[model samples]
Target: MADIQRLSLNQATVQNWSVKEAVDGCVRHGIPSIALWRHKIHEAGLQQSAQHVRDAGLHVSSVCRGGMFVAPSAAERKERIMDNFRAVEEAKELNADSLVMVVGASTEVPIADARQMVADGLAELVPYAREQGVKIGLEPLHPMYAGDRSVLNTIDQSLAMAAPYAADEVGLILDVFHIWWDPTVFEQIQRAAGRIFGFHACDWLVPLPDTLLGRGVMGDGVIDNHALRLAVDAAGYNGPIEVEIFNQALWDTPGDDVLNKVVERFTALV
Candidate 1:
């Protein structure tokens, strides 16, 4: 059986839940950790949100995002970076393990240019993250999100981008839903080794009707969660396993019921 303590609920899994409710849900369900999102954190008030998580005796696995360097101009890029700095600060205040970065989507600029922007932006933030004693998790979102969500779309690319910094300063977010289709996933997991910041669990459906909201619960779709779990474990990642599905159906369901199903699936399939 998967150790319940190692399993974490990403707030997006139950999108409708208030921050307080999510934290309390975790506490009630014996979930010892969570990966939080920015909107929900702001909605609950930062200090209060932090206190609530602390009061619940929950560990924050990571802060949901701190990237999006692909902008139309220098000024826009600067604004994005500034916003990311605040995200880093929030992560630190929450005592999160890492500040997750979604990087950026491809804009009018060439894809190469957008990628360089990501690298350049990180060059600036990595120092600050390290200074604040927080790791920057470079999450390579799926290729499908390349146009509007993320330009970094593979583990190898994410690792290469993070190569300039030490593992403690820059790491990778390995979401099974995103990278499961990559042919070299297993090899890259081994390559990631100590640099794996967090491992996210979700399933990708075939003929995905709604790309953004089509994520299936663990074992309900095609992913072999057990195999992927073993791979991450063998790669020496002993951190929280975060469930980060973005399904409208799941979100519409009652929060407690969604969490219970998540725990059940995690126990049986992950």
Candidate 2:
């Protein structure tokens, strides 16, 4: 059986649940951790959301998310960095393990320039995150999302981006749905030993339903979640393994039912 104590329900997995509802669901289901989204936090009010999780004694694995560094203009990029400063503040308020980053991609600039923007944005935000006692979890999306979702799409790229910072200040968030196809993923996971701050679990649907919302639950798709989980664990990261599926079908399902299946599949598959 998977280690139930290490499971975290990323709020996106239960897209329909309010912050209070998500916290209560985790409590009722014996889930020890949760990853909160910013929009939901705003909906519930950050202070109240923090209080609810604290009262329930649930660990905040991460705050999703804080990066959208690619923009057309320098001023816009600065604005994006300013927004990340706020995200760091929110993570600090929740006492989250890290502020997860889905670094942005853009067609407005060359891909090389966009990558540089991400690096520059990180340089500006990491110090603020460090000052606020928050870690920045850089997540690389699948290459399919490279045009719009993120320019950082490989463990090698993310690791290089994080190399200049201290492990605690900036680290990688590995998601099976995103990195499972990479030929060098296991090698990179080992290379990421001390800097793997977060590990997310979910599968990639065989015939993708939607590029952005096609993630399947642990066993519902093709990913080797158990092997990936083992690799992440072997990399010296004993943190929460978050369930972060984004399928619209799962979103339409009742939150309780989703959590039920998540726990079942996680134990049996992940």
Best by TM-score: 2
lDDT of 1 at 6: 89
Worst 10 residues of 2 by lDDT: 212-221
Best by lDDT: 2
Which pairs of residues collide in candidate 2?
none
Per-model lDDT? 0.92, 0.94
Which digits, one per residue and each the tens of the lDDT, describe model 1 over residues 1-270? Answer: 578888999999989988899999998898999989999999998999899999999999999988999987999999998999999999999999999999887558788889999999999888888889989999999999999999999998999999999988999999999999989899999999989999999898886859899999998889988888899999999999999999998888999899899999998889
TM-score of 1: 0.98
Q: Global CA lDDT of candidate 2, please?
A: 0.94
TM-score of predicted model 2?
0.99
Candidate 1: pairs in clash: none
Q: Give per-model CA RMSD.
A: 0.8, 0.7
